[model samples]
Target: MHIAQDDIMQESYPTVLQLYKLALLVPQSTAVVERGFSAMNDMCTDLRSLGQQTLDSLMRINLYQEELLEEDLELVVDLFKNKKERDMPL
Candidate 1:
């Protein structure tokens, strides 16, 4: 008796392969989120009353700039200093 040799692949779970592929593609790290939270905690204190827009800008800078150069910071400061004054009527 001679057994015929045929190469055949059997997928026990069809969806498992797709799910596993997706799982591999997704980011497994929460470091960026954690860092943002940490930065917010550090930056915002009871004494500091930061507006929503200001806080958002600060968070963006903190999260993106790993090492900000002094010249870049000076430029930022100059821009803020020379920013158009909003005359809010009380």
Candidate 2:
């Protein structure tokens, strides 16, 4: 999970860095994505011009992040489960 800007330290970083670093992941869940989209929607409510290329790239990143978050959401929530609640809320 280490990221070094120095070319010499390239080996310090993992041989294969994560596609989406869970350690660096923020809010790291679908809830955050929903919140972010809500904020972006509100922020851009008055936006005039967004270029097609920029928009497409944004769409791609958003989709990738959303998918990553969704995929990890359940496994993460499970980590907080208590033995008593193991079979409580599914």
* Highest-lDDT candidate: 1
Structure candidate 1, residue pairs in collision: none
Candidate 1 lDDT over residue span 50-88, tens digit each: 889999999988876856654488888888789898577
**What TM-scores do the predictions have?**
0.51, 0.24
Q: Candidate 2 lDDT, tens digit per residue, 1-90?
A: 335455545655555344335456665468867865775564345655567686656656665787877899888777767335555664
For model 1, the superposed segments whose C-alpha errors exceed 4 Å read 1-14, 25-29, 66-90
Segments in model 2 whose C-alpha atoms lie over 4 Å from true places: 1-44, 66-90
Predicted structure with the largest TM-score when compared to the true one:
1
Cα-based lDDT for every prediction: 0.73, 0.60
What are the C-alpha RMSDs, in order, of all predicted structures?
Answer: 11.0, 15.2
